[model samples]
Target: MDRKKNISMAVIKRIPKYYRYLKELAENDVDRISSNELSEKIGFTASQIRQDLNCFGDFGQQGYGYNVKELLAQISSILGLDKEYNTIIIGAGNIGQAIANYTYFQRMSFDLKAIFDINPKLIGLRIRDVSIEDIDNLESFIKNNEVDIAIICVPKERAQGVCDIITSSGIKAIWNFAPVDLKVPNDVIVENVHLSESLMTLSYLLNESKITE
Candidate 1:
């Protein structure tokens, strides 16, 4: 999706949270909801929600607020959740296996097509019903399959090389779990998930409070 120059990255990041909140509202049988109510529940200002959705065109009515199900459907379309993605996982380590087992990914339209690893023992082993293939056939496998995304769970040492291989193998996007930063072409999107950094930040926040106390 070509990002509009008008919308900031911060607003884009908040879309998922809004989607989650809307899903919760739907679960509670909410038919319609006001921006004020959303603001209180979502922790974002009503105007901010208005501003973000306005960028995609008018979704909310003046008096009616917004239809909960319709609004969620709109948000899902905006975030490309409506599109089906054929994804593969690189590396069959703990992180890779866990990601492969995440049913949430499939529910979100990211269907795992296969898992690849260099380890001989892991190769041909099935995790969550998807068999891990040899890394040697990774490129060729992508070439034949309708692979849209690659989940990188390899070690930092292998990440860059894997990035280059996958990006060149016709994958559209990368969800990198490796700690090392990866470089890719302008066309390929990369989302680096640094678990340890996030954990350390949480640790620091907790320790800072303890130290002050």
Candidate 2:
């Protein structure tokens, strides 16, 4: 989809936010929301919201504004939430366990197929009904199973090595939680979640807000 490729990453990032807010609205029994109302809730201009949504296709009608549930479903499909993606988490540490235990991932269509770790104590253990496999069997498991994604929750020192192994095993996408930037081939896609960097940005914003006030 050349249209998808041409879309700005900022706009792409906002799609999840839109889905989340629409979910919240759905929960609150909001059946419909005008662009102006949506702007108030999401803090983006009505024009901007329309522009973002229009990038895909026209879903809004002249008089109906937007159907809340239908629009949510549309955004869900656009974000690839309509199909289930089987994923394996590569670490069983604190962060990894939290992700493993989170049922939200399942709701978002990311099925936790398995977990992998090098620690002898963790291997064969179960987290949220998914068994932890030894890292040694990772490649075999991946080959035998329909694994769509790999999550790297290892430490910085171990992150690159784990990433290399997983990528070499034919994994196309990786969600890396480790605090390191990984080098991957052109065919591989890596989304690094740098919690510290995000927190630092928040800190800077808070300080700036206080100064402005």
Candidate topping lDDT: 1
- Give per-model TM-scores: 0.94, 0.92
- lDDT (Cα, tens digit) per residue for candidate 1, span 1-213: 333566778888998999999999999999999999999999999999888878776788998999999989988999899999999999999999999998998999999999999999888999887999999999999999999889999999999999998888888799999998888898988888999999999999999999999
Against the hidden true structure, what lDDT does model 2 obtain?
A: 0.90
User: What TM-score does model 1 achieve against the real structure?
Assistant: 0.94
Worst 10 residues of 2 by lDDT: 1-10
State each model's CA lDDT, in order: 0.91, 0.90
lDDT of 2 by residue, 61-124 (tens): 7767888999998888888888999999998998999999999888788999999999999999
